[model samples]
Target chain A: MHLAEGVLPVEWAAVWFAPAAATTVIGVRKLRSKTTQIPQRKALTGIMGASVFAISLMPIPVPVAGSVSHPCGTPLAAIVLGPFVSVVVAAVSLLFQALFFAHGGLSTWGANIVSEGVAGSLVGAGVFLGSRRLGLSLFASGFLAGFIGDLSVYAVTALELSLGLFGVSELGRQWVSLFGAFLPVQGPLALGRRCSPVGS
Target chain B: MSLRRIATVLVFVAVVAAAVTPTALHRGKGAGDYVGIDESIMEARAQEAGREARPPFINTDQGDLLLFVFTVGGLLAGGALGYLGRMVFVEGATSRERTRSMVDGR
Candidate 1:
């Protein structure tokens, strides 16, 4: 549920920009840290980016929401590509979605990126690595990575909305209520995670 | 498979789940019930020079229900993926793998 420019208050949107920029910088630093080979890194980043873009548009029917939106595909990106690279991929894909599809607004792209990019990198990759260490299966690790990555995206999306440009609330209550929309869809998704850890 | 990856996943799950509760619960109210752009408003905005003409999501009863289903599915799927991804992708130590192999052998 990407917010458009006219819907939100300008001031709050402005408030979120700085944090979004910082998030992006963190992603960039992450990308820099992993370049054992620059060319491969770029290629991987490109692959990850395109994959995320395609996945984000995968159009899972929102149960009863009556509209289809794609999975952020953050989990797969993070697990396969690593966090830093996933962030960049998510960021670029989101940029494209905003510009071409009008899926989200340009002014809010940074905030959107933070939720989709940084959160996915951190959560998806984090879980996969951690779970595997604890002796979870590879598929399970991938599933966890993706599931968490997506959740992080949703959470970030909520927090970003909570910034409350329309005088919604200082406490972010306005943003908290949107979780209801995903209920019917999340259960099967979780169970399915047991089978497919990776986004595949 | 590493300690770092596990921690990263958990932290991501915890933070997003904890922080974005409000957002997930209360999304798209403005656009949910939209009948479509107010033609008059769109016209007025068009005259105003630089306004974007975009359609809003109509939060019909069917749509709302779908959104709700999606959210629930998302949570379950995300959580399940988290638990299962860890389980499958991370191979266990000797005992755990041995136990499974032994069970399968029996």
Candidate 2:
């Protein structure tokens, strides 16, 4: 889901910016309130942030695709910390990845955040909560959340890429192929919870 | 050490070896082998669409620098995760028990 530097056009980048920024602001407010209520949670939040940074950036090779791909870490973060707070964690990690690692570019950071942060977190949290409501055990619910949430990041990325690269006209034709490219590697990784008990 | 601790360490080592060994051995062979899907697939598609990925501002792709950064980052994150585990499972559980006992005594 790393949209490298200059991948998205300026217009598309701007299009992604508004919602990403707004969501991040909401995440910040929510996190502040949470931390304020329980000061000890600060440590856990830091741990989650670090985990997101490491997990999302670590590329594992999948023999099926003969290529490596990163796992989105937002799902597990969302399950443990609230979805909004997970968004903040993802945004911060993505920013660091953009600046230091060059995995994603500054220009396309907003789009990356939207996919990996917003969509991943919401879907993960929703799936986990819904599964629990349906009487699924914690492990079962976590597995579903991680698997679906990981795939959702790439799904959203494909949409962004289609819209940004081909405009609105070719979106219907492009996203499927784009998303398909990710499946070979991501499918198995997501099944393994991206090599952790909880992760995308 | 306890059996669980030994097992955890062994598992961690095995996972690291499994992830790193093949890629390290096959270095400089072919572009496709172990290349990130981001570059092999997504970026390729973007290029076909006439939008190219420019060089990053601080290109960590320079000769094992990316690997070095990942190693350092992994270590720091692992440390934090260890602390998190203790906080949530060890200290937090103990604290809850203490609170329960206090309430029962009252």
Candidate 3:
């Protein structure tokens, strides 16, 4: 779930926004460069963006933790579209979510993008590439990519929230607390995401 | 049905069952009571400070109107950008082939 608007101090939000903006620029450049190959890729990107929008909206409640959250599709996007393009897709999806669903806040958009888009995409691509290099089958690599990508998003979110709310002094404790609260729901969601053939 | 088909159906049934059973069993606590990460952060902050920390921006009637405007604007901007990006970058083989064929015929 995205941090609500005004949850983070303005400074912290700005701080996170910097990297997200940078990556988005890079992604756009990359997309432009790759546009010559096939129109299908562009179509795929638009379709994937819609998929991410839909998937992120459906929050399933985890009975164990009494928390509700949705599975992120960043890993799948990164695996198909590359990390940079994935970041753009995430940003677009998140922007719509904030505007339409009130799931995330506009003020904290940067932080959410950083956590879900940047961290999730990069880590997912790295894991998928690494798994392929290690001789894993495509299905196995994709599963790991999606599973770890989902978890990493939450981890990054935990870190961001902790830093914003608790500052540098109590970062560790706060991260753990927030992460723990996220785990019960996130863990199952991640597994389900990995097992689902359509998304992974 | 094949095993794969059976498995898919079973999975679908299980998911539906899981989603419905929980809500049926648990009542009184509103859906919002389920602590999302955003609410959890707010609760934690409020606990430490001994005061409620309200969300900075919330949805209002005016805000919804603004959001609708933004959504339409974003959609237009995204579409324009996508079209421009494709025009500038994409070189379809069929179009190139067609051009070559036309030149050769001429």
Candidate 4:
């Protein structure tokens, strides 16, 4: 769900900064549980960021659209690094994508970061934690976590595109009138935990 | 053409190609709307609402399934990376010790 440049614009994106900044703080603070040093943490961050880009490179064909949705790599980053570091991983990877792939634009970086970063957190905390608590296998937990992460981002993407400044087209104004209507369809897919096998 | 001129021409071509590619793809879908929604919106809504009242199509079922698959694949790939990183770290640790011992003539 790479937002095209000026989709939501910089002023709107600025609102995302507070959440991302808070996530970063929580991430660094949570490192107390690990024996790893700052250098190692930095290294993990870089590696996870690269993995996000690399995974997206392996295209998944979406035959209906004739264009595939590239992997967001959010859940992967969360699993590799702690869920908290996912915010950092997403923010960094989106930054890189903005510059290199022109996937997301400078003006929309913060918005992309928040939407993606939050998705990673949802999977990391919700599916992973909840399933594991219920004694689900690591593989199942991981699968569910990732499923939630991807759907959450898609819902967010649909929300921002359908209702945000870019808005539904004037021709489709009647449908746009029901902007909030899709929430029911979108929300459960975004949050529901579908059962997956022990290992994906 | 001089190298600089050739480079300029190539850059221009690249930019134009990039711009037109998405347009070409969008037209293929029979979707003219600027906000890029996939075909499902049309399939689900077209007949019921007719073309005039078409909303952005979201095939939540297929979309969710595709999304889950992407995540599963991404996670496995990330775990592999994490595994390799740990291996490289271990190798680096030992290699560093070996170099230290060599320089000291131990």
Cα lDDT of model 1 by residue, A10-109, tens digit: 6655776776677667778877777655434554555556556655644554332223344677667777667666767777766656654445566666
Chain A TM per candidate, in order of listing: 0.82, 0.97, 0.96, 0.73
> Which tens-of-lDDT digit does each residue in A49-131 have in candidate 3?
76676576666676655667778888888998999999999999888778656677787789889988998899999999997
Candidates 1 onward: DockQ, in order: 0.04, 0.28, 0.14, 0.04
Tell how far residue A158 is off in model 2, in angstroms: 0.3
Predicted structure 1: lDDT: 0.55
Ranking by TM-score: 2, 3, 1, 4
lDDT of 4 by residue, A81-129 (tens): 7777777667766765565443565666666776677665556557677
Top model number, DockQ: 2
lDDT of 1 by residue, B16-77 (tens): 46434533554453244322221222223333434453442332225366456445544544
Candidate number achieving the greatest lDDT relative to the actual structure: 2
What tens-digit string does per-residue lDDT give for candidate 2 at A59-121? 877664567889988999999889999999999999989988879999999999999999999
| lDDT (Cα atoms) of all candidates against the true structure | 0.55, 0.84, 0.74, 0.54
In order, the B-chain TM-scores come to 0.29, 0.65, 0.40, 0.36
Q: Which of candidates 1 and 4 reaches a greater DockQ?
A: 1
Better of 1 and 2 by DockQ: 2
Docking class of 1: incorrect
